[model samples]
Target: MSLSLFIKYIHLFALGLLGCYLLRYYGDLNPVLASVLCGLLFSFLPFQSFIKSTKGQGAIYAGTFAAMSSSRVLNSINDFVLVCILGGLILTLFEGRFEGLGGRKGMIAFLAVAAFYMYRSVL
Candidate 1:
C-alpha cells in the first residue's frame, strides 16, 4: 500500500481500537453499543472529511470486529492489537469490493479474527 493509504489505515485502526476499548470499559462491554456509540462519536469529529470516506468508516468496523473476540481468544493487548491490525490490512485489501452488500465489514472482521485464532492455535 502507498504511504498515504497505510497511514489512513492506521488512523482508522486506532479509531476502531479506541471505540472498542471505550465501549468495552465504559459502555458495559456491549459490542453492539460500542460500535454504535463509537460510530456516532466518530461521525461528529472534526475530521468529517476523512471519517466520512469509505475506507475510513470501514476501518472502524473492522477494528471493532477484530478486537471484539472473546476473552478466551484475545487474552492480551498484544493479541488484541494484532487482530485489529489484521482486520485493518484485510479491510484495506478489499476496500473497493462488495459495495452493494450488507455485512461485508463484519464478514471481513470475522475472517481476521478467525485467522488470528487459527494462527495462535496452530503455531
Candidate 2:
C-alpha cells in the first residue's frame, strides 16, 4: 500500500480505538454524553439540512461540531451554546461567499473552535 494510504488507515484505526476507550471510561461523563447527543441531533435535525444542502456550509458545520465534541469545556450547556454561537459567527464572517464547497465551512468552524479553546487556555 502507498504510504499515504497506510497512514490514513493507521489514523482511522487509532481513532476507532480511542473512541472505544472514551466510551468505556468516560461514557458516564455528562459532557461526553452531551456532545454525542448533540452530534446525533445535528445530523438528524431538519434545520441543519441547510448545511447539507450547501456543500461549504456542511463542511464548516461538521468541522465545528467535531471540534466542539473534542473540546474540554463542553461540559456545560452554557459553554456548548457559547462555542456553537462563536463557531457559527466565525464561519459567517470569514468564509465569504463560498457556500458550496464541501467541508470548507466545517474546516473553518473547526479552526475557529480550536482557536477559541487555545485562547481560553492561555487566559
Candidate 3:
C-alpha cells in the first residue's frame, strides 16, 4: 500500500478498536444500540474524509460486531483488539467484492471472528 493509504488503514484500525471497546464496556452494553449510536456518530462527524470513506465506516461497523462477541468466544480485551484488527483487514480486502449487497459488513465481521477462533485452535 502507498504511504498515505497505509496510514489511513492504521487510523481505521484504531477507530475500529475504539468502537469495539466502547460497545463492549459502555453503559447498557447493547450491541445493536451501540452500533446504531456509532452509525449516528459517524453520520455527524465533521470530517468529510471519514464521511466519504466507506472502508472506514465498514471497519468501525465490523468492530462493533466484533464487540458483540461473547466473552466465551473471545477470552480477553487483547483478543478483542486482535479480532477487530482482523475484521478491519478483512473488510478492507473484501471491499467492492460485495458492493451493493446488504449485510456484507456483518459477514466480514463474522469471518474475522470465526477466523480468529479457527486460527487459535489450529496453532
Candidate 4:
C-alpha cells in the first residue's frame, strides 16, 4: 500500500481506539453518549492533512485518550497528579519528540493544565 493510504488507515484506527476508550471510561455520560460525543469530536478535527502527514497524529490521539482514560482508574489525588504529569510527558515525548509539536508549547501546556484541573475536580 502507498504510505499516504497507510497513514489514513492509522488515523482511522487511532480514532476508533480513542472512541472505544471514551465509551468505556468516560464518567459524565453513558457508553452510547460517550461514543457519540467522541465521534463528534473526532469528526470535527481536520483530517485532510492528518491523513496525509506522517507526523504522529495517530499516536497523539491515542496517547491523549489513554491519558484521559486513566482518570477513571486512578483512585487518589496523588495518583491522579502523578499520572497526569508522567503520562503527559511520556505521550508528548513519544508522539511529539521528532517534530517537537511544531513549537506549540503554549497549547501543550494549556492542555496539560486543563486536563489536570478537570481530572482533579472529578476526583
Tens-place lDDT per residue, model 2, 20-106, is: 234534565554354455444445655434433443334333433444345454445455445554554554454346555555544
Q: Report the poorest 10 consecutive residues by lDDT, candidate 2.
A: 8-17
Residue-wise lDDT of candidate 4 within 1-123, one digit each (tens)?
244544444445345445545565655565445645665566567776653354444434433444344444544546444434543454445453546445343244335545655766898
Cα distance off (Å), candidate 2, residue 119: 2.6
Error of 1 at 46 (Å): 1.2
Clashing pairs in 2: 56-101, 59-103, 59-106, 60-105, 60-106
lDDT, residue 121, candidate 1: 91
**Model 3 residue 79 lDDT score:** 74
lDDT of 2 at 87: 50
lDDT of each: 0.74, 0.45, 0.67, 0.47
Question: Would you estimate the TM-scores of all the predictions?
Answer: 0.84, 0.44, 0.76, 0.32
* Candidate 1 vs. true structure, TM-score: 0.84
Best by TM-score: 1
RMSD of 2: 13.1
**Residue-by-residue lDDT tens digits, candidate 3, 1-123:** 244553455456556556655765656667778767776676577765753577767666666666576668777766766776676567556656978889887787788889988988888
Tens-digit lDDT track of model 1 for 31-60: 777777777777677786777886788787
Worst 10 residues of 1 by lDDT: 62-71
